[model samples]
Target: MARIQIDLPEHFGFSTAIPVYLSHINYSGHVDNALLLTLVTEARVRYFQSLGYTEMDVEGVGIILADAAVQYKSEAFHGEIMDISMTATDFNKYGCDLLWRMRDQVSGREVARGKSGIVFFDYGTHRIAPVPPAFRQLFE
Candidate 1:
């Protein structure tokens, strides 16, 4: 598995934290695997909101996840706060990729690392299109 370190600056963007609860626990009494995806996904939602990118704006040439992968390196216990740092990288004509690093807020240990490919879509025309200048402008 490949891993990379992402430096988060105060003004770069926003960060969201999600707490793991007993409901997210599995039979093993640890954070469930699917729970990790759920937490990371919530972080992505906040990331989009932070960018001021609404679903209406992405209606036609919106973004879609091309690929998503995560590797669990540590276990998060119930009631542990997970800080998910999201940043936009590799922005281009099509879309931008988001890199995320999730760690236990208190211990400061990395629990998982993940990446997702977001693609520009032309939902109206049923074709793939380049990201709109406005959406691209948010990062610039």
Candidate 2:
């Protein structure tokens, strides 16, 4: 069997802190695998908002999460503040990869790292759209 490995970027352009709620913890007394994605989703939204955009509107085009890959590092517990950092990379014609890293705020222990593959879409035509040049330039 092989393990899924995610190579994080050297620097992230955005960062935010989110605390783990009791509901985020599983019976195992650690953050649930599924909930980790929820945390990163929040970070993703903030990342876009910081750039004056949203998941549904990036330079007049909506973004659809094409795929996601997460690599958990350490167990995170309830009440722990997770510091999440993100950046955009791997540009293609229609989309780019959003990479992120999560760590415990107090302990500074890495909790997870991953990337979300995003694709630009046009709601009016219900079709894939080319990446907006202005949006691509922001990360480049």
Candidate 3:
């Protein structure tokens, strides 16, 4: 696996969440991976919104996921408060990358880490395009 270490931004924000009844123990008695993705997705959308960006229409330049990677370091159980801290740390010609680190609110242990590759699209031409200069200007 190609691992990327993300340096989180100070302004990066988190979304509040509480485990649901449906998000109960799996047969193995742990939060399922599918639920984890759902939870992460919710927080990610909020992150983009905080940055004045989104999965679409990122400052008039549309972008979609080109690739994604996720790693599960630990498990979360029902009734847990999972604080998902997220940020947009990097971008390139082909796409931008969003990094996420989720942890237990009480224990301060990492529950998961993830990175997503976001590629720009020319909504008019219907073709992939380079990330906008403005988006690039937001990062290191």
Candidate 4:
């Protein structure tokens, strides 16, 4: 069997702390696999907001999640604050990979690492849009 490996960057451009709630836990007493993605989604929103953009509008175009991958390193329990850090890399014609890592805020133990594929879209034209130059410049 093979496992998914996520190579994180040395430095992250954005980070936010999100606490695990009871609802985020599963029957086994750890953060649910699905909800982990939710935590990442929250961090993603804040990342965009920090840049003064929203998921629906980034440099005059919207963004969509093309794909995602997660590699869990440890379990996260309720009430524990998770520090998620993120950065954009692996740019293409219409999208780029948003890489992230999650760690326990107190112990600094890594919980998970992953990347989400984001694609720019034009709502009016109903087609994939080119990565906005202004948006690309921010990370370059």
The C-alpha lDDT values of all candidates are: 0.77, 0.95, 0.74, 0.97
Per-residue C-alpha lDDT of model 2 across residues 1-140, encoded as one tens digit per residue: 88889998888999999999998999999999999999999999999999999989988999999999999999999999999999999999999999999999999999999989999999989999999999999987
RMSD of candidate 1 to the truth, in angstroms, is 3.0
Model 4 TM-score, all chains together:
0.98
Question: Candidate 1 has which clashing residue pairs, if any?
Answer: none
Q: TM-score for candidate 3, please give it.
A: 0.78
**Model 4 worst lDDT window (10 residues):** 55-64
Off by over 4 Å in 3: 1-21
Question: Model 1: per-residue lDDT, tens digit, 40-123?
Answer: 888888888777665335534567788876777888889999999887777877877778888899999988877777888877
Predictions: Cα RMSD each:
3.0, 0.7, 3.1, 0.7
C-alpha RMSD between model 3 and the true structure: 3.1
In angstroms, the error of model 1 at 6 is: 9.2
The TM-score values for the models, in the order shown, are: 0.81, 0.97, 0.78, 0.98
Per-residue lDDT tens digits of candidate 3, residues 94-113?
A: 68777777788888877888
Q: Which pairs in model 3 have colliding backbones?
A: none
Q: Candidate 2: worst 10 consecutive residues by lDDT?
A: 1-10
